[model samples]
Target: MFAALPAGASGSFGLHPQDGPHVDVRIAITDDQVTLSLTMNLVFLDELIPQRREQADLIDPPESSQTIAALLEYFASEQPLLVDGEIVEPRIEALYIDDPSPELMPLFPRTGMRGLRKIRFELIYPLSSPPDRVQFTWNSYPMSELTGGPLVIKAELTAEGILDIVEFTEQERGYTWHRTGQDIQSRMLQVPEPVVQQEDSSLLSTISIIVMAVGAIVLIAMLVSGRPAEALATLILMVILVPLFYLVGRPGNTPPTKEEARTIFDSLHANVYRSFDYVDESDIYDALSLSVDDELLEQMYATIFRGLIMQEEGGAVSRVTRLTPLNFDLENVGMLSRPTGPGLPEREALGFNVLYTWQVEGTVTHWGHSHSRTNNYTARYGVIATEQGWRISQMQPLEQDRVDDDPEFTLDEDIEL
Candidate 1:
């Protein structure tokens, strides 16, 4: 079913705002207590399901739109008894046992609910749809995605289930893509690059970012693994960004026909001997351990790539922009010090770089065949920088936090992409 948009607007791609007015809410009789299990799957305007291989890569982080906590609180306030209206809240348990279809799931689920982001339902009553005027709500309706974040909406749903979700703005424009069951599920599973993601830049930038990020995280892991001098020295130089980390881009956007996935990442192809006047062979080897091809090291062709892999001691250099590296100011440099990024300032004194980790919680949608859906991932990144000029040392500590992916009442179709 398509949501209706105004005369000419597009927030999502095509599904109008008026379609899917309330949310796919499902109530079940799992036990005596009411169980809430899923929430709306929010995506980008260009990100509705049935995505092909040419679609754009999902950018920014999942929490990039808004905090998951706020979305939950808003759902709790809409329970039937909590508001005054005549429209009846469907007794999901009765509906599930009596009949079942795609229309019965809650876009927003409440089980294992984070109390910090939820409001308690103090009572149970009946709520009428739009025409009767949803008593205490102003969120007339909710569309699936948001640009920058989400746009404010102005809509009204009638008890008959017809809705008009419009943007409450002068330049109103948004769209919604709609579908059901297996069609959407199959399309989604086939989409998205098979590789797990790491934050930073684009395709050319990705390879560099991953290598640097992992290396940095490893240093911290190394410190924990008992390499104090290397960690300490690495941390000091990186804090100052003597060397910088690098950023690349993403690979293909959607799924391809029969094929092997091919991805290209960026790197530092600088001639290191031109920047610093010090040449220490052992130090350079330790930093570029990953890039080293031992058999090729005996040859002379890998000098430029080898020398740039350092924060400690390497061939001296005469130029700065040899290869634009990712900024490694773990402290407060380069104007990119976000709380969600890693950095350290106290230990830059001894020329060592330190790795910091940014903890993030967000949602992701995998194009699941026959059923497009969304799940949450808790991720942490390791960032490192040096003191010489703030070059990035590595990006390690790459791990996804494990959390339960179910709400008490989820019926398998409420999650959005």
Candidate 2:
């Protein structure tokens, strides 16, 4: 979606009002509830706001909160959604405006799609079961009431753990999904009528955005697994962003392939380090449970990461570990036991052995001063495939060693890394 705003309208704080009209809808559904996210290009909103402001008095300026709030109100009322044949009110969880340049630039089909303003909104609705049918209208207010007869729109919907994806124009509004006996069916309700619109131009743009979003969510996983090379490659492609957690890493779905198993493990492992690295001990157990069962969850907590968190003697202590090294030697890190053979099928478990060597600098009370130490670890992890993807079901240390090279410092305490 390419659009350009008039001169002096890009706002000092990075708001770019563009000329194109695009709406991106992302929907995630579970057994009990549905979460939807909408991203609307501000070009159409810029045109529609004047009509609304003239009709009412709330809208003051293009980038003001009042204008956004007013627009959100109209969007909520006009949003067409149904749950079990009844109209459902989606509760607004967040509403805001952003500059899409930083995100859209890295996307392919850049198509000079820069300097555009985006209105991002999230809505959550409770549902007893998955809706059998959907009546989705992209932008009713702009299409019905704006100065333009019908603005161009690009709508995208992704249902979590479901293979069906909906990406079409405003004309294709109705959709259906149902399951009978053992089969599930999903299809658009009617054939879309042809319109004089721009050809679908954002295929690469959509893919790039999804990849960027997924990378942002799971980058930490790659980091904790001693895979900084992979994480760094992704970081160079685009600025790191934290999208809504629900969009990526379908946590409840099984990983049918080895690559997926590795991805899930990376997410789980990185989250474990994040909890400990940030000193949030309470979250370690929950993070570990993503890849492991209860038995291993309790075991790792009691035997490994928890043991490291309790090493402080007294007084104030500070530790800093630098993860991003410019000249990192990837060969130093090794995977000892990878679960990549027929054994995994018979045992229903995957195992991994990863070796890491790193350094830390900090001050401890017993030392009464500052010191540096080099740490080395050879760790093995095991995960079992379950109904809800793969989980870490086992953890054990294959080897552990550390080196303190300061002659003045006596290293007597056990360190956790």
Q: In terms of TM-score, which candidate is strongest?
A: 2
Q: How well is each residue in 289-380 modelled by candidate 2, as lDDT tens digits?
A: 54456655566666544334324332232333322111111221112232334545424333333232223343221100122344444455
> Which parts of model 2 have CA positions greater than 4 angstroms off?
1-18, 47-73, 99-115, 128-130, 139-152, 168-170, 179-417
How far does residue 175 in candidate 1 sit from its true spot (Å)?
A: 18
Model 2 TM-score (2 dp):
0.32
TM per candidate comes to: 0.16, 0.32
Candidate 2 C-alpha error for residue 200, in Å: 62
Candidates' RMSD to native: 28.3, 28.8
Cα lDDT of model 1 by residue, 145-253, tens digit: 3233333443321111111222233244322212122221132212222333454446545655666686699678869989898887777755544234332233222
Runs in model 1 with CA error above 4 Å?
Answer: 1-19, 22-357, 363-388, 404-417
